[model samples]
Target chain A: MRTVTRLYLSNDTSARAAGAGVLADAWSEHPEVQLIRISSRGAFYLEPMVERDSPAGRVAWFNVTAQDLPLILSGTDGTPVRSIPFLAQQTRVTFANFGETEPLALDEYQARGGLSGLETALRIGPDAIIEELQVSQLRGRGGAAFPVWNKWKVAQQARADQKYVVANADEGDAGTYCDRMILEGDPFRLLEGMLICARAIGAGRGYVYCRQEYPGAAKTLRAAIQKADEAELLELDGEPFPIEVVEGAGSYVCGEETALLESLEGKRGVVRARPPYPAQSGLYGSPTIVSNVLTFATIPNILSRGGAWHAALGTERSRGTMALQLGGRVKHPGLVEVPFGLSLHQILEQFGGGMAPGSRFKAVQVGGPLGSLFPASQMDIPVCYDVFAKAGAVLGHGGIVVYDHETDMVDLARHFMAFTADESCGKCTPCRIGSVRGREILERIQAGSGTIEDLALLHDLGDTMKVASLCALGGRAPYPVLTAIEHFPAEFRAKLRT
Target chain B: MREQVKSVLARVRSKPPNILKALLALQERLGHVPTEAVSEIASALGVTTAQVAGVLSYYPDVRLTAPGRHLIRVCMGESCYANGCGRLLRELQDRLRVDVGETAAGGKFTLDTMSCAGNCAVSPTVMIDRDLYGRLLPSQLDTLLERYK
Candidate 1:
């Protein structure tokens, strides 16, 4: 048999955006080499990183370009992928299969301990599975931090002929791609998680409401579902538990569970008031278990390892590992999944490799665009739900975006207000109109035409939005703006007219 | 245009019609959902035209008018914004002679902005059609646009 070298390249959006496709195209010229496109390891700084399966192990070359193809092909210069500090440092639970297997390969997924959770769930009954989830103390990773078992149990008990398991892959948060990473890279894990949910909740069907911007992730997920169907992995009680991928129409508010349910039902993405939550009435007036991609992706592990085992990892309230996406002015922007309670300073310095050269870190925005801005002084706060909540900040979606000295807080505040105004579903008055009013005030401040009264007015508007808004989109929309004005008041003051 | 819209709707139409899916399919096939598609889709799906139009207008991705040959979407996500995407947007507007949400003079390109594509690790990202380019700078606009044109 002629020996063929296996070359691994990341098919991740960020990796491809960083020119992985160019490298893959260049390497494909040689027929002797087998090109295996794997999911990104989340060490985005090293992309378009390539790995060559050497005699010893997989050796990675950082930032490989077409020009460096000669050395990569010759197998001369590369470091062992495991030894890379970025990949080796953290605990990877949900993203364990990342960069390890081809996204759509069922055999590859199975060989690497996939479907073990479903097996465990099959062995144990639904009540026992819920008990396991409760014992594990697994909270939803979708920013709300709701207990996962609570939702599952409600769906389990609800009397409905049709129930739904929805994975909110509508990761519209800026600086966050962990959900995208899971959907694109380890999609089977998500499927396996969904299967476990189906078994627990008696859901007949599942839908992954993927965002329109992430066409690549959606494509990968659909392919993975097809493979699962072909392998009979999606069957329950002799009927296939059909899983569909629904693409969002660029509505950020749809990430909210009720809105997501509304959107999934083929309606305008609008926020539905929640006396009877999705767990009670959702998806055409049926019981629905709506969780984000990361939350669903975390289920398989909680099942396979036992809930108590997961419960032992993190802090009192927040258990297991949190997938933190570090981006912006950080030197090494990527995904870091570790147990809860690591300080922001530690995460930024260690996993993020500190601030990028020539830039001094001014503030860091944790969670999505809706998250609060924390100054460098507050970086010592532990990365846990309770502590962040106490500080009036959110660990929403675990997106940490660092801002350098060059960033004007006023402009940023304006940007977020504008973002909220633009993305408001127009169902709520406070979010729809208040956001526009907030943006105008910020713009006036930025143009040096605002007074102290405007600042007071902003605070008043933010308070009303926080209290009266229908959903988190309106409620949390005030967080970034309020936090900005609170932490960097001088920046806003400086923008005042002379 | 009516026939094209009807054909696109016919292909995606199901028992319980997925209006969003059908509209998306129509947009995918026709580049934009023509005003004529609203009633056709509503009638096909047993929905009101207002419902169809409401959904069509709600999503930024589903457009009302035809776009240029190529679509250019600059990510306005926080990370991209932090990395000076505003300057890049201005540069694109100046160079293309078209503002955001407008097509160029000769219909060569349509400029738009996305909330975020989740490619924030490499900030200042731009998507020309389906291809996403990251770590973009204002100075590189000329070179980047040259390829699309």
Candidate 2:
């Protein structure tokens, strides 16, 4: 049989929304052409990135449109497009398989060192696997930044009839897409990561708690699960451990671990008090380890290449790489997997190519709506978990949303409060009421009715909410408001009543 | 609606946790989880109608009433907002003669806002029914909405 090389275009959210599906349909009629549907290249700016599997390597084209099809199909489109310099400089240990192999294509994945981590783990056994993770110095990418090994060791030691592992795919953060990129582009890696975690903890079942807003990700995951099942990749030494995906019902609070479990069990996604943490008793009263998708995604790389190799990359405390999702007013806006020590200036100027042409750099929001806001002067801060905390900012989920000069900080602060108020599960009085009050205060300031006394009240209310709120939704909800007032005091002052 | 709910309920075990799965299945088949369907789901899952209704209402996706012929969900996330989605949303509402959370008169369209559609690269994204339009401008909305009408 003569092999006809395949031309790939990812079926990711960015591509699909841009009418890549229509192009795929149009190209399907040609027998001479093989259009393989793979995942995104992570740098969404280059999508509908068209790649052809050639004798030399995968030839690539950028921003491919319907009109370019004839030129490409005719073999006139030359060599696979060279690696983008932005992507070339990336550390890329975790996102190694993205845009390189067919998603769920076991042969393609296996050829490119896909399941080597799992193989290493199976050979070394569970104790060694846990030790390797500890050596890696990896932390949760799901905003909390808790050490990954701590969670795994606790789950390993806690004697329960059944142990469960969950991947938090509930990426409710506004400007983040790394979780969706991994799930849609390289789903098998995510599954492999989960498998490695389950093996280390002696767990029988796992689930990916994904947000329902992402119908594309959900569909891709279902397809990938079938592919994994067919290959028997999830089975460890004849003990079958199945991984299931549970869709979140459009609640931002559910992104929190406890609320996630509540939603999984068919509840209203309310926050539960700690001490009996999910690590201790979770998911039907069984011991569970709930981790973010990136936390698990990093596991395969750590196990494949020794934990020391992973640990050697980043700062002493925050090891390995971080998948930075650049959004808002940036030129090269997309996902970048870089080492953890890069400064905000390097990320914005070098990787992101600074703010999009006309938009003057004003402020950047790190993390989600609940995350702190940074002024242009604060761009020297290195992107490390501990460093970020010390500097009064957080590297939550590595989502960097840039704002131009025209943007009103007062409006942005109000928007954050509004988002929190709308999404609050009403689990605690402080969060439920505090967020609404904060929104009203910001609104009053915006309407030119707020006094300087109102600023003091806002700060006091923020402090109360920070201490009294149930989970992060309320606890961190004041971050943007307080930071906005602190950093962009002029914006609030200009709006105050004379 | 009861028969439809009963059929979906029959597929899964009559357990407490299956309420979400059951409601989702019902929502997929029927646009919304109707009052009758909620009662049937509650009875099948061994929970009360209020419990089932509470679960449905809690989720932004699962609605009580059926959506209009076309669902226009604008991405209101940070990226989209930065790229002038607020203007696009306002223009869409004005053209449709409806608010953000209401369905248009004569049952043609339902205007709503979503968190993040994961289409950050192409900001100001709008999904009309199953088709998503990205990098949307207020001027282009009329032409885009024309297809659905």
Candidate 3:
């Protein structure tokens, strides 16, 4: 047999625009080299990442360009990426095969323990599967850290003629890309995860509700679903289980479960009142399980590596690893999946290598645009669901967007409110009206035309919106505004001056 | 445009719940959904034109009017904004002579902003049509724009 060296090409957005340049060069010259396009390594700083599978093991190069093609084709040893402490040190249960394997190659995925979870679920059955999730203490990674198993248990018990499962890939969180990476890179992982969910709930059909913004992820996932279908991997319990990919028509509120379901059913993406929670009566009035892509992506690991093993990894209550995306002013911007107890200082300074050179770090907006803005004083705070909540912050999606000293908090806060106002679904009064009113107040301060009493009014409005809004989009629109005012009072006060 | 809409809706299931999908399909084939097609799509999907139009208008990407030759979407996410989408958008407006949510006079470009493109690692990202450009600077505009036109 001829020795074929496999070089992995990442389809990540950052890599897609940049990595394609090098891939074109490599393909033109080296036809013999088996160039495999894979998902992101989670660590984006090393993107346009190429992995060389050798007899010795895997040698990977990060930040590769077309200029590196000659040296790569020369057959000389490339950088051993796994040896890098940033990758080697962390526990990579969910993201284990990320950027390392061909995204949709079924045989390759199988060899690397891909569908083992579904196989295990098929063997142990739904009750045991739900039990495993409960024992694992896996909470939803979709901003709301609700227990994962509870949703599954409800869907399992709900006596509906047809059951549905949806992977919420509408990742509108500004600073987050892990969901995109999973959908694009390790798409099958999400597919397999959803497959596990289907087997658990006896779902006839599943849909990956991706945002239109992620054209790349949608394309990649579609291709993966096709590959999975061709491979006969779509079957569960000997019944043909089919999955479809639905594209969101650019509505931020649609990231909320009910809105996503409404969008999936081909309606105007609007928030539906809960209590008949998704598991109780969802999609076409059938019992449905709506999970974030990351939540589904985590299912494979829990099933393969027993629930107790996953439960032991993180802090009490919050179990397993979180895929933290470091963006903005950070020197090393990428995805880092660490156990839940790491502090912001460790994630920023130790893992992120701090802010870019000469730039003084000011604050980090955790979760997404809706997440609270934290000052440097709160660096020691651990990034867990409960810890962040106690500090009046949310660990929504675990996205850390750092800002330098030069950033205007008042302006950023105003911008976030403006974003909320722009994306509001016009469902209810508080979110629809309150977000615009909040932006107007912040803009008045930004224009130096506001009163000192305006701050008190903003606070009151924030309280009302928080209490009355129908969903998180409306409820949490006040988070950035209130937190910016609380943490950087001087910035808002300074804006009040001419 | 009527025939085009008819053909697009022909392939769709014509089910009540599939109004959004049919509209998306119609928009994909023809740059934007025509008003004439609304009644046809509504009839096919067994809904009123008002219902179809209501769902159509709710989405930001769905347009009543056709797009320019090139679509330029600047990401306004926290990372992109923090990295300088503000300056980038201003520079783009100055160079293109069009503001966000508007197209230029020549029908060459449509400028828009997204909450986030989810490519935050490469902050300050912009998407010109199908291709995404990351870590964009104002100076790169001339060369980047030349490729589209």
Candidate 4:
């Protein structure tokens, strides 16, 4: 049998998807390698990748096309594509291996050290895993600053018959892509992360419930799961543990932990009362460890590198890496993972490439809509969780959306209020209806309505939602509404009576 | 078929009332729900076709017809709203002649309004078939839509 070769030449979105078919046809003469494929996220820059299964070892390298496929398949070794400057510098902690290897091809994955963390776990026990994680000081990357160690510790200690590890890929938060980027770019890393979590907390099952908005992510995950199953990774038919992907039905509240569990149970998404927590009683009434995709995705890196190696990445109390989803009025917008405590200006200017050249920076909205809007001068503020807290902004989801000069902060407030209103799951009264009421006031303010009393009304509405809402989705739904009014008072005042 | 479905659903220990999980499992396997799934899912969950159909209808993302080959979901969320998203919405309507939630006639293009892409500064953005188009404008949209055509 001839050792055929398949090459993934690109990470350009459509090209990567389309090239798989091209490779299948290219290898028609020699089908022993089964399939040689290419994938690009349509980035256009990284094209012409090659994957060959030679006797020496499996060869999966980038920058080769079907035109070059014949030569490469004829056993011509290609130059490493990473040596190219433009393609080489992408710091892809999330998308590290995506498009470079076969998504479902387990042998390729295994050869490339895909599930080594799981293999390492197979050698060790859960408590050691927790110890390694705590030493890493890896904080939750899904917005909140809750220590990952504590959450896992709670799940580990919770008295329950069964524990679950659920990945909240339901990233309906207005400005977060750490989940989607990881799931689409590096599917196995996330799978390995979940498997590790299951192993850590004595969980027998895990689910990666992706939000309805991310079709590409959902498709990629489905493909990844079948591959994992075919490789005998997931426990099936009396096997020990099974990992699965649960597609969400397009609800923002489902991104909330409790609502996610309800939707998982086939009920209308509504938040459960807390304290018992999912650690106490979660999906299907089992003790569950519900973690955001970022939190879960961090596991493989933490385990492979050890905790101190990770703790070295960020500021004190905000240790480890952070994947910042840079958005809004910025020039270069995408995912950038750096150590925590990077200043806002450093992110906006250096990382974001500074607000579309001509645009003047007004306010940068951090963490999603529920997060605060920082005035531009405060761009010097460090982006650690505590620093953001002192400034009334939060590190929620590490999403940085910039607003330019022409953009009115009042209009921004209205838009955030509108999103919160539409996305509220109707479980809690404040977020359910209060978001609408708040949105109406925002509308009145934007449409040039009401007296100064509207500001007070906005404040009151925000306070009520904060005090009474079941989950963070509603509790902080009013942050954008209140913060915009407090910081950009003139915008709201402009709408009020003379 | 019910027996086959029950056997399959039993693989996950799904209860009789967990119709959503069952339908989702069907969607998971079939990519999208098939009309045939109504009968199979109902039978599997010990419910009726109407019950299954009713539940499918509740989910905004579930498709009765095959989804478009290329889905362009423009983020109409607040961050997008503040940026040139208003113009992008208008541009999409002008090009596709359909509002958010409506699919295009050709089935190649479906323009739906997603709440957020989480890439807000890159607002006025449309994820064409999940390939994100950041910092989109009327001109940029013209450049992008022409590719599909």
Q: lDDT winner among the candidates?
A: 1
User: Each prediction's Cα lDDT score?
Assistant: 0.90, 0.84, 0.87, 0.71
Error of 2 at A204 (Å): 1.4
Q: Using TM-score as the measure, which candidate wins?
A: 1
lDDT string for model 1 (A1-498, tens) is: 866778899999899999998888877877767889999999999999989876677999999888886688778879998899877889988888888888888898889888888999998979999999999999999989999999899999999999989899999999899999998899998999888999999999999999999889899999999989988898887877999998988899989998888888888889999879888998889999999899988988889889999999989988999999988899999999999999999999989999898999899999899999999889899999999999888999999999999998999999999999999999889999999999999999998999999999999999999999998888998899999989989888887876
Instruction: Please provide, for model 3 over A378-495, each residue's C-alpha lDDT reduced to its tens digit, 9 standing for 90 to 100.
Output: 8899888888888878899978999998899889989999999999999989999999999999999999987788999999999999999999998988988898899899878877
What digit string (tens of lDDT, one per residue) describes model 2 on residues A131-173? 9999998899999999888888888888988989899999999
Q: List, residue by residue over B36-108, the lDDT tens digit for candidate 4.
A: 6577666667777787776686666666666566778877765576567877788888888887767788777
- Model 1, residue B148: distance off in Å is 2.0
The TM-score values for the models, in the order shown, are 0.98, 0.96, 0.96, 0.79
Relative to the unseen true structure, what is the C-alpha lDDT of residue A455 in candidate 4, on a scale of 0 to 100?
Answer: 83
Over 4 Å off, model 4:
A1-113, A235-238, B1-13, B22-58, B62-72, B94-111, B118-123, B127-136, B139-149
Ranked by lDDT, top first: 1, 3, 2, 4
Ranking by TM-score: 1, 3, 2, 4
Q: Which model scores highest in DockQ?
A: 1
Total backbone collisions for each predicted model = 0, 3, 1, 29
Clashing pairs in 3: A39-A185
Displacement of the residue A336 alpha carbon in candidate 1, Å:
0.5
Candidate 3's TM-score reads 0.96
Task: Give the DockQ (2 decimals) of all models.
Answer: 0.84, 0.70, 0.81, 0.34
Candidate 2 lDDT score at position A151: 84
